[model samples]
Target chain A: MAAEVVASTVEIAAASQVGMKALGAGLAVGLTGIGAGVAEMGIGSAAVGATAENKDLFGLVLILTVIPETIVIFGLVVALVLWFV
Target chain B: MLAPEKMSRLLIVASKDQLAPITGALYRSRLFHIEDFVVEGREGYDGFSIGKPLAGASEASGGLIKVRSLENVFAIRPDDIDPAGARKRHDDLARVVDRELAKIGTEVEGLTSRRSKLEASIKEYEQRIHEITPFADIPVDLSLYRGYERFAVIAGFVTKNVAIREPAESRIVKGKSSNFIVAVVPNEDRADVESELAGAGFVASPIPAESGMPHALIDDYQAKITQAKAEIASIEMNLDAIRQKHADFLVACEEVLKSEVEQAEAPLRFATTDQTFVAEGWVPSSRIAGITDEIMKASGNRAYVAELPIGPHDVVPVEYNNPSFAKPSQFFMNIYARPKYTEIDPTLMLSIIFPIFFGLILGDIGYGLILLALCFALRKYFRGEDAEYFLKVIRNASISSIFFGVLNSEFLGFAMPWWPPYSFSRHLISEHGGHGPMIPELLLLAIWIGILHITLGRVLGMVNHYRQDHGEHRMKAVLANAGWLFVMWGVLVIIWSGIVMPLMPDLTGFPMLVAIPGLPMDIPGINVTMVLGGIMILAGVIFIARDSILEVVELPSIISHVLSYARLVAVGLSSVAIAMVVNFISIGMLIEPQLENFTLIGAVVILAGVVVFILGHALNTALGILGGGLHSIRLNYVEFFTKFYKGGGLKYNPFGLKRRFTED
Candidate 1:
């Protein structure tokens, strides 16, 4: 009976470990998204001001604002790899 | 289709008396890109100086300054008011407008000065009030606080409660408004009393220069402050009334005065002798006749227009003359640099390729429709120089996306039954019986596109080289471009045979390459076709190296440029993947299982799915636009433009009126 309790406890801990890994993956993507948001706040505002002045800057400014987004993509890729593992 | 219009130089000489008519004619014709008249000695040229402005220039400039000041005062832009209405009002005030403007200008100046003085007086009164407020409870005349030989007064603020120690004969009084105390002590113990006050964190306040009691002086200053504030408010009201009456008039007057000043000052660009003024400029070859006709007609033939024979070295201004459909692409070209008159204008090329690249990455019918709707909405709501070109590009891109979306059979993330699948749409629809990884197919398609695009550039460059007067450099360019084209084809063939063939084992019987058989000549893991491709590439490298040894380093860049097309695959794949994840979260997990029963909980789940769907699609659409638009533009600008474009031509900037409040 003592052996059975120990085995059940070990199984529960193992399941929780997988759950923790899933949580870590979620945190990675979420934190990176928040980071991208913070970066875009300043760039997006400046881009809006610039586009307001000259509409020709729309394409260039869009490119600049989206550059920080590559960070989130990297994070998402990392999260996917981790989840798969 | 690519080259800018040919330009011809014009030298017009007219009498100084005819300067007015000539300037008027030039302004009206609007075809002359007038070059700045530099006074320099040349063959058949004599002493000349820059022409002075017309007689009315001073008055016009003064009026412009005044109207601009009025604009600043009112904080109103010309576009804020109705131009047609302002023009009518301007006409109504034409006879009396100048007098009214002067009167209002002086009145505003006087009011502004008075308002500033009142503000300064108010500040002074407030300071006096502050000085007196702390001692309001002292109940002694301000004069009594000072000029006392036997008693010493130390009035200030202290954070802690005051305590009279021995040898400090003191009377401390605290005020109601703040922790400010007024203390009196014997003259002998004044320093001791101040030290006691200092120990309790006391800051001294200066005595006011008044004779009345502290409270009475404070009240008097408050009354004066209120009176001054009232005067300022009245002055502001007067200014506001002036703004209300004259904002539109000011904007119109400003526009008119500015035009007058510009016209009067136009002679500054002309080279003048004692009696004759000579104007030299370039006009489009096509418009040369039209401009001559207009100048003669407008100036009554007083100005003699002569076409100067332009030499090869003449710096001609470039003007793009494309159809309205392709005209918008000039925005992109202009921002990069105007194409030289000798080189091809790449506007039409950009118009064709930019949309294809944008569409390929964002190929989804649902998203395309959304973008199409947005384009329509933007067009309906906004109208400006900025909106016009952006909308033009977006409209083409949206249409192309719709077309590619139909080809790909995608709506949002889901596929339609009738259309071929994403990977199969571009390749053999029948042979690949099952779906394979689309990334490889997309990458291959992207590389093929790169090859074709770069080849077109090289061909255009070669044609440009041949079209020019042949020199050693021109011959080298022709050979190098031809060799690079050969290398590109070799690389394409190698990629087709080596990599694409291995992917599909079932396919067979394509074009066979000549295998160069040798003894003991083997590199580990190198393919036979690649080795053949290397030899073919060396042929181009040899030609390039003959001209510039350093240029051979750029050979690897050719492969990198082709590989850069992988962005097209990566961006599109990311968009599709995100959309699928969104669909799964919204529909697959939430609504799929309980969707059949339609209970209250199921209804809630469906509602949640709907919300998720909207938010998810919104995010995806934004990302799609950024990625699709920029990556496509990057491929055109970084890859294609670097191949052949050498853009540093002067844009043709003709003198013309920016008519805002007036029709003529």
Candidate 2:
């Protein structure tokens, strides 16, 4: 009975640590969306301005706007890593 | 020494009846003055002497005479001249002319001085008239039904008989209670009579005369005022023309004096173009290709050209395209070549960086959102390119800030796990000690970020050099950048494992030795690994120092070039330090509590604290961005550019349609 209690306690502690890490990862990625939105705000406006000046820059603007989105992708990767680990 | 010059002339004749048409054709050719002679009994014969040689005309017409001489005509079309050399000559001439004109300007002052005295007398008479008629009002009436043509108007009558003075034609009309008096006079003489009447204790006001006929009493006053104004304007116009001519003459005189007094110089070169002719002067060897191309394009191979190399270095080749409008070219050439043209085009680079840095420093999600909204709204409402550009930069910076804020793990001073999923001991809660994992991690991250940015700059420099065909230099830059990156990484790794102890021990002895002594030696946690880490750090420092010192001597080949990235670290550290300070200040505001009953006061205190936090952080963010962005640009200019950039290459400017605001 004493051994079983000790085992269960250790299992719960391990589960909690994993859960905490997963929570951290999720928060990182979820919060990164906010950051991504903020970044897009600048890029989208710049893209619009560039497009207005020269329609040929549409491709360039689209590419540049997506560059900031990489930050969020990184955050998402971190969350996936934590969950998988 | 002056060299011998050559001359070319052309002569042509047409029927006398066609003289006007032939002259117009010659004018179109931009050739100067044609002399005509009338032959006895030859009523239909006209002859033209075109004294000025055509720019590129090899063929001759039957009725035109063109002459090319060594003497330079002081015409206005300097744009036909080489831009650089012509600009220098123009400036030299302009300075001398300005000095001489300034001396003559004193004479203008004397003429204008008399105007002030006359104006003062006029004002005195006006004041006296105003005093007598203090309570008087001029009544004007317009009626169509007075049995007059179209409309009739009556104005300004006194109940008592005031001695009426008619300066021009006096006319009397019968009225109900008073006799109406009318006058007709020129506008100028009317003003003199008005002043005279004012002096005689009568109030006189001159209104706009009805059609061509004016009131007989006021007509004389209006005529005098008109004459005065017209006289002043004519005098002023003459004065202005004289000033301009004096200036031009003075310039020519000064050039002659400088040549005689200082050194024997070449004759002045002038170029002009008009509806008929395009005249250019002193085409340099470097600019010959461009000028020839322009002429060929404009005149289609029919230009008349003259070449006279009269001075040791003066090769004056003048071409006249359309001479009628060519004089303004000289004026254009005079104001060209300002330093602003060669300065770096800041538009593109500024657009990219400003907002990114601004946002990073601002770092608060809420505040960034607010700024983003404001900027966007302002840009939308104000339809200007500058406003739009500003908004774009702000939006980018805010985005960078949001990213930085995430790394900071802060949102309105609230912790990530607001309702703690699992609470650690409440006893462990201390303001300084309990900061979440973000701060230390961010500090480390900033250093790495600096390294990355510097690497990117070096890579760009390498690419730019390679594009310019400097392969060896590009290779050197790449190697130097790589060496620095390796060294920095190596040192960081050792410090991470041996001293900080947050990560597992990975790297060995050299770093430990240098880091131990360099770190707080008396700190309790100093260990053998720390000592080894210290040694490695010291070695890295020595490597960097050695390369820097050697760069002054043998140019460290490619190894020393990588040191330019140190600015990246410097700016990043500055940003981090500013961010920390902002956090501390904001947190400090929430420290003291108000009395228990004064709950409202407590809320007010919180609001004040929030305000201070926002303002203080916003200011710091602005300063940080400016510092970082400027330093980043400095690093590019001073370090990277010195390695590869050759910025002195001359710019290419093609002649095209230009507008001069000075004429209007």
Error of 1 at B470 (Å): 5.5
Output the number of the lDDT-best candidate.
1
Worst window of 10 by summed lDDT in candidate 1 chain B: B500-509
B313-367 per-residue lDDT for model 1 (tens digits) = 7778889978778887777776666788888788999999999998898988889
lDDT score for residue B22 of model 1: 74
lDDT of each: 0.76, 0.41
RMSD of 1: 7.2
Clashes of each: 1, 88
User: Which whole-number lDDT from 0 to 100 does residue B90 have in model 2?
Assistant: 32
Candidate 1: segments with Cα more than 4 A from true spot: A1-85, B41-44, B79-82, B85-97, B110-149, B158-162, B166-179, B199-201, B207-245, B376-383, B416-437, B467-470, B502-535, B590-612
